[model samples]
Target chain A: MTSFGNEPLFLGIDGGGSKCRAVLYRKDSGIIGEGLAGPANPVQGLERAQDAVLACASAALSDAGLSQSQLGHLIVGAGLAGVNAPRTRAAMLSWQHPFAQFYLTTDLHIASLGAHDGTDGAVIITGTGSSGFSQCAGQQRFLGGHGFPLGDKAGGAWLGLAAVQAALLALDNLGPATSLSQAVLAKTHSQDSTALMDQFCGQPSAPYGQLAALVFDEAAKGDAVAKAIVADGAGYLSNMVLQLTELGPIKVAFIGGLGGIWQPWLSDAAKARITPALQGPEVGAVIYAQQRYTGEHAP
Target chain B: MTSFGNEPLFLGIDGGGSKCRAVLYRKDSGIIGEGLAGPANPVQGLERAQDAVLACASAALSDAGLSQSQLGHLIVGAGLAGVNAPRTRAAMLSWQHPFAQFYLTTDLHIASLGAHDGTDGAVIITGTGSSGFSQCAGQQRFLGGHGFPLGDKAGGAWLGLAAVQAALLALDNLGPATSLSQAVLAKTHSQDSTALMDQFCGQPSAPYGQLAALVFDEAAKGDAVAKAIVADGAGYLSNMVLQLTELGPIKVAFIGGLGGIWQPWLSDAAKARITPALQGPEVGAVIYAQQRYTGEHAP
Candidate 1:
């Protein structure tokens, strides 16, 4: 066993809209413990995010058989959602963390790093929201993480919104009735258009994301409306991939809940650039910490 | 001047998402007074809507040189937005109103009544939201009006959302840059995609509805993206008109802020069935009160 004074311990955190994850690690032994907690997106709630970050970090220390007092002895690196906004970033940077050292970055940056195992590459994320990010020759580019109703085309929430729109049109007899519409009605437990509208009225993107699977399933079964919706979303993602590729020769890795599902629908050129992710964003956070620490401590 | 006791005073109220309008009427004097107040949609706030209703009514009485106590003698007919929702309707119905008799119905219903001067007809409304309503042969039919994001296609908010989506795509280099995109960026004071996204993040339908005029202006200037957006929305509105016409031989009257802007884009078939509205929704509420009072007193 490495003594506390002889070897430094690291904690890596990946925080997002729905949940926060932390991994405790050592250079010699790799991952020693893992932790999970609720939402940690600063844009949603700065106080809640801070609480979640501390909770996950504490859980990670406990998981590694360490005491909470050891927080001051450990270095921490965090990749958090919504930190791309300058205000949110500033707010997060002001957190009075309990770590010996703490580093922060946007979730997309860490995600790209993790996809390429701390090397330069591109990543397309299609979870509840959609976005593309790349780092090549120390230059970074970001595209299409605009959120639901305004942007985020090809993301889960976008797909769900498209499905609901089509289903409603069909129900109103303004558009053709299809199996996709039927499935949407069934999945939402809505007997008619009014009920379906009631289900989504003034709702956020999460609930819409939950309905995404219905689109893929119906499209796979040859529903024209579903196929059209999928094609439109996939087309946008494919264009995003092409746009990202223009930045550098970096291989692109797809990540997030709907990432794998979108693979088959991408253009041949987009598919050609696809690669498997080497690690998760938590590992990317650790890599970020190591790089920052080395650069700051260099002679 | 008709004495209040000799000629019963009738108050008609048209309460919508943004404002409430009241008209004081009598058979001998016609419209004698008018009043207006803000945001009276019960779905947004029951208490606020109730207060606005009373405020508008009090203003109408004051305009007509009547005391506040005269409310107890005035028969009121109200056509309110959001009363279509059963729960909101029930809550509104439960209010201990000060009027002698209060009859409540949906804004769409009153609009249709006023458009046809209490005769049977169909009406299409395209404001911040969209909907179609027709009353013919003692049967009523309603369409669209599902609200923003989920539905409300062809409405101001829907048109604005489509424009923003196109603008973001153009900014990201995934779609062609056009005058529509340029206008959106300029109107929102956004320098780039990030800034544009920031401007609309978590915004409600009202802000988006404000952008509708941009689409119309760009489309008029022959911008392809804007034209396409307008075409899609106009197609939906035309389809809505066709669907409403299927119910009966009723002439359809287009109403609301964007109603006239959408006229030139509608199909010839839709255009053939269009007619000018004879009166506003507040007058429809008066007609409703007259019908109800006459029916009750007839035997």
Candidate 2:
């Protein structure tokens, strides 16, 4: 009935901190349909991530002009955020997903695959969080991306956090009173240190990530503290990029919301090895499904 | 009726991150009994804090050989952690407490009160958390103690967090590898960065605070990174002490579990300003109750 006989439908999903993206594909027709949903990182919430995956899958099927029952006919590849944690990965693996076949991996892995278009390469993601992954010579290496507060250096959340820290120290007269501090105070609409601190107490990284742009804005205006923060972050990313490059002569693709902003700040050597991503992570997920499915069914 | 003519029994409570402490006192007999209970920081949990307060109060009454119904006869003073946040304070104040009268203030306030023996002075608390409070010339000033991952420099949690960050950087080869990193890995039983990060993910400040001694231990052995961390924290505290002293000619007392460990690290000027607290915070709570009660009943 389909364009090609005995060809299976492939569903690729990229689940991240804020949203989940899905693509329904067939070998004969490329991507037939796509769908989107919200907050599918298992580290944030396991049940919520699972629900988003199923919902996006169904939506993708519907968008492809197919019935919901076609979900069971689709082979799926999912790249989810927070699955690197052993416990989170286990919880996800226990999921009774609705699909003919399922393959799961880290969001970084999918991003890398898609960046190089299923070839060997490295990807540096600088969104709400930061991390690097490289697959070369049949080996994979992970760098940075330890999560917020503990790590995730050069990330949006880290930039915002550094700005807040500088502001608080200046407010207490323990650190220099820079324009960056004033900028942070103005951005948060906080009249004083107490108000500023209160706004961020017990908060997750998303709220901090929201403040990251302020740091860059102030730095561009030649704020010393802001510049220092940016330099430190960029230095970390440069080091990460260099380390990822050590896994061979693989091209490193800087991707994510803040990726473009960080590009110029990298070292000249790091910049030299940079390349544009071939496709989005959602497409990488599909490639993952196809590879795994073929590997399993091979003679 | 009880001892001195018509004098009421005073119950003083110091509610903190890990435990609640209570002291029962009377005009004729000072500190007749004391009791301790579990964690009572309202920022951590509202109902749990309330329950800990009640439990500690009940235990104090029992220790003083009084019946549970005696809860209604005692005037209470509670100095709780996190009450500096208006929301946490409002929630705590709304408790339907079983006491003849309830007086509430921040733990820092009572610490300052008790440290100076109800006189004008300053107190810096460096424990599982950190804060500075000074009462002088009919005015009160609050400093630092912004809570973990935000502020609280020189606090145990801050020290531990800095160590972890250093260790992670070293493991990633982004920073110089020091004995501090080796010690942290051994302490956490982690073979690499992933395990170290895993142990601290989504963890509260208390767990990090537990690792603080490792920093001090390594610093004592002349580890450059550990020493730098200590110096940075001490510098912040030194500045805080100088600011508190600027309020007036006030004696500053370093208080809390880690207070003594940090004392020798402070600047000579900060050291010169330091004095020993005359009493613990629980006793300070009683002083707070008496001061409030006398003020209310006067004229």
Candidate 3:
């Protein structure tokens, strides 16, 4: 394989629990190709994640009309879920790769960098789980990304779990009856808590998280229980964002599948601080790769 | 297979999720023999539950100096968990048995009867789950006992889940920090919500319910979060009991492993209506068997 005369080809990858995406770029040519593949999170398995990344990159290469041997001329950066763990990161870093150079970081980290043009800022992610990160003055403060039943107060799983709990309370007439309870009962085909528990307890976190969208829908229609849950969740997120401001006047971006759904619920002060992200995590990966590759070449 | 003419031999069995207990009695004598076996809840498996009940009864017979051949001389009554489900009850009723006569009822049904001396009264079972039953004026009213994450407001699982949720909020500085959070973190050896969620989410309801004792213990020592959880639970139970009173002035007994633990938290009005149980579900099973056998004999 020969270097393409310092044309500086780049492959940027964003790998998450749901999917892996790659964007291939050439300096001054912008994005030349893009590819998509199945889930590539490390928790799924090192081999599976690697295969996903390779397949996505290969597709991007094909899209760019490039050959396999050209891989040796490319700089690569990956922002992936479950890469925050030391063991996972170390394993990926040590793995054999054909790229000219490789850069690795968390999906959250890349999203934050991209949100603020690679400068200091904060981001709150409320997808299947919830968490927030604020970087300022060369220091970072993290909050609320703990996962379901722990810190994901306003996250999808938390919302669904809380909704189920409330529905049970309503069924017993221990709390006010609401339409939210009826909806859950209908979905589960359960007339009471015993049926509901027997059916739902054995399921993993995803089914519970899926119910969160229904809750938000009910809240929009003026269901008291759903409204209360949404308000409580919003309160938690608002407090988190307000605390981010204490570190510095950094722009805060809400980023995640559920982030846009919750945007209207955030406090006015928090909403005022919010800014649109300039690009997706994949673009962030590209920018990150460019910066790191340039720094190495400068010296 | 011959009868012990005019001599009544009684076997009362209480089958629950954890274990099965059998007591043998001769008409003129009090408890003459006792035996124990493993969990006999039919939900676990009809075969396994049946085997547990048989093993427990056989042990009691051995203690009473009876051979397997003497099974035909005994009249057996069982109050078993999962028998409340019609399918389980019908299956057990239809199964072959060697006893001279056999009667079946739910653990909750017999618990109510035993607690109130075979008379009209009520019982709220607050063990790993919560459920209430009131039998008065020849009618029965059932409430709450929906199992974890659905019902069981003041039940162990609910308390533990609430404690974990609180600990995460405390960790995020979104809520008051308390000793309960410290205790949970210490027990799970989890430093953050992510670690805690990964550890706790996979576990079944029992482990979560077990942590409830810790929450109550913390509340006793004045942990604000613990106190709030306990109070919220008590509020739910209070509402349940008050609704039960709407039927009439019936005596109420709290039953099960965790029943006594929550007694002190009952409201004064609720406490005033409370009464000590006359006997346990096993004894109630014996009494029920005697009544049925005598009624059969008369005609």
Error of 3 at B178 (Å): 2.6
Would you list the clashing residue pairs of candidate 3? A130-A145, A131-A145, B130-B145, B131-B145
Docking class of 3: medium
Candidate 1 iRMS, in Å?
Answer: 1.0
TM-score for chain A of every candidate model? 0.97, 0.95, 0.91
Candidate 3 lDDT, A52-151, residue by residue in tens: 9888998888888888777787899888887776778998888797888889888877788878878888888888888888788878777766555545
Tens digits of per-residue lDDT for model 1, A1-299: 23366366888899998999999989988998899999999988999999998999989888888877877877888999888788889999998888888889988888988889999999999999999998899888889988887888888889998889899999889999999889998898999988898899899998999989989999899999999999998899888888888878888999999989999998998899999999999999888888888888898
State every prediction's TM-score relative to the real structure.
Answer: 0.97, 0.91, 0.89
The candidate with the higher lDDT, 2 or 3, is 2
Those runs of model 2 whose alpha carbons end farther than 4 Å from true positions after fitting are A1-4, A42-51, A67-73, A84-100, A293-299, B1-5, B38-55, B66-75, B84-101, B292-299
* Two-chain complex of model 2, DockQ on C-alpha atoms against the true structure: 0.60
* Ten contiguous residues minimizing lDDT sum, candidate 2 chain A: A1-10
Off by over 4 Å in 1: A1-3
DockQ of each: 0.80, 0.60, 0.50
User: Each candidate: fraction of true contacts kept?
Assistant: 0.81, 0.62, 0.57
The true-versus-predicted C-alpha distance at residue B131 of model 1, in Å, is 1.0
